[model samples]
Target: MERTEKETTYQETRRVQKGDFAAAGQISASYKNMLKRLGVDSKVVRRLAIASYEAEINLAIHTLGGSMTIIVYPDHIFLVVEDTGPGIADIALAMQEGYSTAPEEVRMLGFGAGMGLPNMKRCSDTFEITSELGSGTTIRMGFNLLN
Candidate 1:
């Protein structure tokens, strides 16, 4: 579901620049810290941390630019990640575990083992993704608080 900050009682958004390796994990780590401080369940925080880090890494390594947003609802936690351009050509294929389009150098860097989307989906209570070949990708994930 498409949502804005107004829909939530609490929200945090961070812009991710393309190829910003130096600042790669900082954004998601901040999200984890905020979630913990807000008294979110430890398990939920761990799942979001994993999913957010994956989304953050994908945006930093793949797209032109994007944002990572966290929205807190009464019974759920939501994440929205949106990117600029060069979106996935095949979302079905991309969702497959161990399937990656990463370059040789990126793989050599010990990242992009094709687990990002799969991990995000596995960790979230609900997940949706949209992508256009030349446009961009957006991923929405929800985690249930009662879980």
Candidate 2:
């Protein structure tokens, strides 16, 4: 099931940089702040943080650049990330546990284990992704506080 969303709430936006590993953690922090301000508990906040961060880094490492948007409501938080990169040609394969298209340097840094999509799916109550081979990719992650 998807997180229940309200028509109005606090929102935040962040710009993700291409190949900027150093800035990878910023999205998670921003999500956490949004959650806190909305009076969400720490446990649920942590789950949302993990999912949001993974999605953010996936954009940074795989795509040229993108933006992360967080929407916080009373019941849950929603994260949307859009990137301009070579779309996943085989999404099914890319979702596998050990499949990744990350470069050798990224692998050496222990970043891409083919777990970004899986982790995002695991952490969010409802996850959605859409992409095209030559266009871009967009990921939507939702975490429910009621769970």
- Model 1 spans > 4 angstroms off: 1-7
Worst 10 residues of 2 by lDDT: 1-10
lDDT of 1 by residue, 33-105 (tens): 9888889999999999999999988998899999988889767888999998799998999999999987787
lDDT by residue for model 2 (59-95), tens: 7789989889887766667788888877888878877
Q: Which number leads on lDDT?
A: 1
Clashes of 2: 0
TM-score per candidate: 0.92, 0.89
